[model samples]
Target: MPETLRKTFAKWHHWIGVFCASLLAIFCLTGGLCTIGPAFDHWVSPLPPSISKVFHTPSAESVAVATEYMEQTRGEAPAFLRLPTPQDPVFRLIRYDGNAFQTILSLHPETGLPFKDKPSLETGFFIALHSTLYLNRKVIDFIGLFVSLAGLGAVISGILIHWKRLKSDFQLLRLFSPTPRRALDFHLFCTLIALPFLLTALVTGVWIESQHLVEDFSPRPVISVTETESQKNLPAHLPPEAYKELYQAGAHYWGKDNQGFFLIAPHQALLVPSDGKSISLTRPHLALTQIGVKSWNIAPSTDKNISLTAFVKGLHLMRWATGEMRWVVSLSAVLLWAALGAGSFLLLMKQRSALNRRNACPSRSDKIAFSFAESFALSAFGLLPLTLLGLLWLEWLSPKIPLSLSIHAPQGRVDAFFCVWIGLSLIGLAFSLFRWVGSFPFADKALRLLWKITLKGSVFFALALPFITLLGREWRHLPLLPNTASLLLEGHFVLFGLILFMCIRKNT
Candidate 1:
C-alpha cells in the first residue's frame, strides 16, 4: 500500500513481465493448439483408407493372430491390446516406458496384420513440447520451477502495481480512440479479462510439475511380498486377447451401458470400466473405475474407486472434462494467449521507442536487441500461421507427389514444416528487418510487396483447406460429426486470414 513499496512492485512487474512475455505467449500458443479444434489433430493420423473404410468386429482368433505377429516381430513384448471399439474400430497394440505410451501398431480386424504403423503429423509432438520442451526430466523440472515461481511473482506484483486500476479499468475500453490509446486499452482489458485463467493455469501447472520433480529425486520405498511363494511364482501365459475376452464377458453380462478401457502393464492388464450413469470417462480414474485386472500371474485385482492424483491430472489437462467444460478450458487458454500477445506488443513498442530516442547516442546493443525483436514480431505475426497452413497443404499434396520428388515418405511432412518455417523466416528477415535497418533508399519496398502478396493470397488458400482436407483419401473414414468439426476449424482459419488482410495500411 505504501507508495515506495508499490513502485518497487511496479518495477518488478514490468521487468518480470518483459522476461516471461514471449515464452508465456509461446506456452499459450502451443497449449491452445494442444487442447482445441473442432477437428481433433489425431484424426489426421496416417491410417490407410483401405483399412479404415469398414469396421470389423474383433474376435479371439483376430487377437491371437495379431499377438503372434507382435511376439515374433516386436523387439519388446506388446504390453496390451485394445479391442475393437466404435471410435477406433481396430485393435491397438500398446507398449509403455514408465507412464509414456508408444502405440506399437494397429492391427487389422480381419487380417490381424499391422496397418500403416506411422502417423506423419503426430498430435503427441505438441504435447511433448508443452510438457518437457524435449529436455530431460531433471532439466525440465528446473525450467518448470523457474516458470512457476516467476509466473506467480509476476501475477502478485502486477496486482500490487494495478490494485486500484484493476477494478476501475475492468469495464473500460478505448476501441474507437486513436491507435496509441486504443492499443493500451486493449492490452489492459485483455490483462484484466485473462487474469483468473492465467493464475489457475500457472498454479495447476506448478503443482503437476513439482510432483514430478519430487518423485524424480525421492528414494523408492521397500515393499514386503507377503504372497505365498507358489502364488508369486505362478507361471502365467498372458493371452494377447485377454482384455478382449474379459471385455466381451463383461459386456455380455453388464450390457451396452457399461464401457471402459484397459491399462496394460508388464504383469497385469487392468480393466478400468464404467457404467454410463454412476461412473463415465468424464471423470473416471484408475481407482474410480478400475473393476479388476487380468494378471499374467497374480489374482485379479479387487474393485477400486477414485484417485486424488487422477483428479488433479484431469483438472490440469482438462482430459476428464467433457462438452462445455473443454470449451471453457480451451477458450481461457486462448484468451491468455491474446493477453500475452497484447502485453508483448506493448513491451516491444516501448523498447522500440526508447531505441529510437537513443538513435543519436548510437547504442549498438540496443539496435541489435531491437532488430531481434523486430524480426521476431514479423515471424510470429506473419510466417507462423502461413507455415501452419503450409503444413496442411504439404501433407495433402505429399500423397499426390510421386516418390521421385525425393521427399522421404516417413519424414516428408516434418520436412515440409521446417522448410516452410525456415524458408519464410529467412525471406521475411531479408525483406523486412535487414532492409529496414539498412541505408537502402528503396526503404523496404520488398517487404511491403511480399506482405501484400502473402496477405491477399493466403485468404484464398485458407478458405480452400477444408475442401482439400476432405479430398484426402485417408479422411474417408471420418464420421459426419468429425467432418463437420474439421470444416468449422477451417472457417476459423479463414477468418484469421481475413483479419491479416485487413492489416494492410498502404500500397507497396
Candidate 2:
C-alpha cells in the first residue's frame, strides 16, 4: 500500500474503532451466545426418560388421529400437524389464537390426543429473543444490519493492527509484566489465534441478518391462475371439511407414497411424498386428474416465496449441519466473544494512556460512554448466562407451566430472570457509588469488585447444572451429555473472569 493511503486507512481504523467499541462488544457477546443457540435450546426442552421409536414414514391417518385429538383437547381447531421428528418425540399440533401460534403435543401416533405435559416455555422464549430480538420485522432487520456492519469494521481494523505481529505474539503472556503494553500483547495474541473463526461468524451473521435485503433484491415470481367458468359458479365460502377431503383426493393422484406437507388454499395442498410428482392446480385442474374426487372441488397452486424463505433461513442458521459441524459453529461463537472483549480492552487502554500522558482525565462525555459500556458488558453479558440457567431451572422444576404461542402464561421464570439480573445490577451500582463517595480509586476498587462478583456468579450458575439435573424431578430423566457441555462452558467463563481480574491496574 502507498504511504499516504496507509496513513489514511490507519486513521479511519482508529477513530471508527473508538466510535463503535461498546456497541461492537455487545454484538460480539450476543452473536457468540447465538452460535450456541441449539445447545441452549436442548438445555431447556423436556427430556423424556426413554427415547421413543422412530418411524420412517408413518401413515397419513395416524397423523390425522393425533391431529384431531390435540384440537379437541385445546378446544380450538389445529392449523397444522407437524410430523414426529427425532429431536421432538411427540408430534406437535400447531394452532393459532389472535396473538401467536401455539404447539400442543400428540402423545402417540396410534392414540390421537393431546399429551398430558405442557410445552417448554423458557427455551422457546429465549430462542425467539436470540433469533429475532423479540421485535417487529423492520426493527429486527435494522438491528441485524447495524450489528453486522459494526463487526465487519472490527474485523477489518483488527486484521490491519495484527498483520505483522501475528506469528510472534502467539507465545506472548503477562504472568510477570504489569504494564499496559503487556495487556495489549495478551489481547492481540488471543485475537490473532481466533481470527479465522471470528471472520467466518461475522460473514455468516451478515448473511443471516441480510435475508430480507436479499429477498428485496431478488423478489419471488408471482403465480396467477384463472378461475374456470364451473368454479366461478361455486359459493364464496367453502365448507371447513372441504379442505380436508380435497387434501386426501389430491394425495391419491400422486399415489400411495404421496403425503401432504401443508394446506394452502381451499382446493390446494402441497404434497411431497417419498416417490411422487409435486404440482399445483386449480379445482378444474384437479378434476381432470385421474384421482376421483368424492365430493368437493379442489385446486393446488405453488407459491415460490415460502420455499425460498425456508431454504435461506435454514442455511443462515446452519440448521442442517449435524454433529461435529455444529461444534465447529459453537467454537466460532466463543472466539467471537473473546475477540470482542480483547478488542474493547485494547481501545480502552489506548485512550487511558493518551489521557495520562497529557496529565488530563477523559471529558465527561467520554467517561460516561466508557462507564455505560462497562456496565452493559458486565451486567448484560452476565444476565445472558444467568438467564440461561434460570430458564433451565424452570424447565426442570415446572413441566406444568403452560405457555401458549399467543398466551403469556404467568411468566414466573421470566420474572425470576429479571429479579436476579436487577439484583446484580443494584449491587454493582452500590459498589460503584461506594467507590465514588469514598474517593477510593474507581478503576481498582470498582472494577475488581465487579470482576470477582461476576466470576463467583458464573461459577455458581454453571456448577449448579449437575445438581439441577440429578436433584430436580423433571430433569432426572435427562442425559449426561448436556451436563458435560455445561461444565465445559462454565470452565471457559471462569478462566475468562480470572484473566480480566489479573489484568486490572490501579486505575479502572
Candidate 3:
C-alpha cells in the first residue's frame, strides 16, 4: 500500500477502535456467555435430588397440569408453554404478569407443581444483558446495527493495513519481547485467528437488524383459508377428548421425529424441531377444532431465500452448533475480546509515547483528551471483568444477606452491578486525573498500583467463587458434575487474570 493510504487506514482503524472498543468488548463477552445458555440454565436451576429420573408424562397431560397450576397460583393461563425434552424434563410455562413482564414457571412433569423455587436469577440476568443490554429491543437493535457496521469497517481497514505482512506475521508472537511489540503481535495474531467467525457474526448481525427493511420492501404474502366440508360443519370449540386426539395426531405427524410441541393456543400447537433445520418461526402448526385437524405450512420465504437466511443465522447465533462447535464459537468470542483490548492498548500507548517524544508541555486540551482516552481504556480492560466478577459474587451472597439491610437477592443483583461499576469508574477517573496533574513517573506508579490492586481483587473473587458455592450449599444440593456456570466463570477468570498478570509483569 502507498504511504498515504496506509496512514489513512491506520488512522481509521485506531479511531474506530477508540470509538467502539467498550461496546465490542461487551458484545463479545456477552455473546460468549450466551453460547452456554443451556448449561447456565441447568446450573441455576438443577433438578431436585429427590427426582432420580424424569417421568414420561403425556404431552396433553403435562399441559393440563401446567394450566391448572398456573391458574391456581397466578390467576391466569400461561401465554406460552415450553415443552419438556429428554435433556430437561420440566415443563416451563411463561405468562405475562401484568406490566408487560413475563414470569417463567417450571413445573414437574409428573405432579405439575412448581419446583422448590423460581428459576435461576443468574441465567435470566446474563440473558437479559446479552440480548438487549438491558435496554428496549428496538434501542438495542439500533445500537447493534451501528456497532456492527463500525466493526465491519474496522475489520476491513485492519486487514487492508496488514495485508502485506499478513502471511508472514499471522502466527508470530513474541511473549518475551518488549511490551509494545508483544502487544501488537498478539493483537494481530488474535485478530487473524478469529477473523472468519468475527466477520460472520458481524455480517449476520447487520442482516438481522436490517430485516425490518426487508419486510417493508418485500411484498406480503396472501393467505386464503379454504374451508373443507368437515370444517364447514365444525363446532367452535372442541371437547377435551377431541383436543387430546388432535394433539396425538399432530405428535404422530411431526413429533415422530422427536420434535417438541408447544401449545400456542387452546386448539393450536407449534413444533420445535431440532436445530439446523429451516423452518418458519411462526409456521408448521397443527390447528384443531371439533371437525378435524388442520395443519398449516406457511413458509418463511421461498425455499432458497429462507434456507440461506436460516443457515447464516445459525452460523451467527450458533443455534445449530453442537457442543464442541459452541465451544469453538465461545473461544472465538474470547479471542475477539482480547484482540479489541490489545488493539486499543496499542493505540493508546503509541499515542502517549508520541506525545512524550514531543519534549514540550502539552496543552490543556491534549491532557484532557489523553486522560479521557486512558480512563476509557482502563474501564474497558479492567472495570468490565471486575464488574462481572462482582455480579457473580453478589449472586452467591444475596441469599445470605438480610432483606432488611436494603438488598434484595437476585432482583438486586443488576442494581448492585451498576453500583459497583459506577464506583470503579469514578475511582479510575480520579486516578487518571491525578496522573494528569502530578509528575509523570509518580502518577504512572500510582495508576499501576491501582490496576494491580483491582486485578488482584478480581482474581481473588474469581478463584473463590466455586469454593463459596460448594460451601454455601449442602453437599446433597450440589451438582453431580461440575456446574457449567462455575466452570465457565472459573475459565473466564483464569484467562482474564493471566492477561492482567502479564500486563503487570511487563510493567505495561
The worst-scoring run of ten residues by lDDT in candidate 2 lies at: 275-284
lDDT of 2 by residue, 305-419 (tens): 4454444454555544443455555555544444455555556567545645757765766655555544555564444555555555566666444444322342555566657
Q: Residue-pair clashes per candidate, as listed?
A: 3, 6, 0
Alpha carbon lDDT of each predicted model = 0.56, 0.50, 0.64
Better of 1 and 2 by lDDT: 1
The per-residue C-alpha lDDT of model 1 at residue 326 equals 50
Displacement of the residue 156 alpha carbon in candidate 1, Å: 3.7
Q: In candidate 2, how many clashes are counted?
A: 6
In model 2, which runs have C-alpha deviations exceeding 4 angstroms?
1-42, 50-57, 69-81, 94-106, 109-112, 171-314, 349-358, 399-410, 418-448, 473-508
Q: TM-scores, in order shown?
A: 0.70, 0.65, 0.78
For 260-357, candidate 1 gives per-residue lDDT tens digits of: 44554333344444323223223332311222354422233343655555455655665654444554555555556555545555566676567557
Greater-TM-score candidate between 1 and 2: 1
Give the lDDT of residue 182 in candidate 3: 70
What are the root-mean-square deviations of the candidates from the true structure over C-alphas?
Answer: 6.2, 7.6, 5.6
Off by over 4 Å in 3: 53-60, 67-78, 95-103, 212-250, 253-271, 279-315, 358-369, 403-406, 426-450, 473-476, 479-493
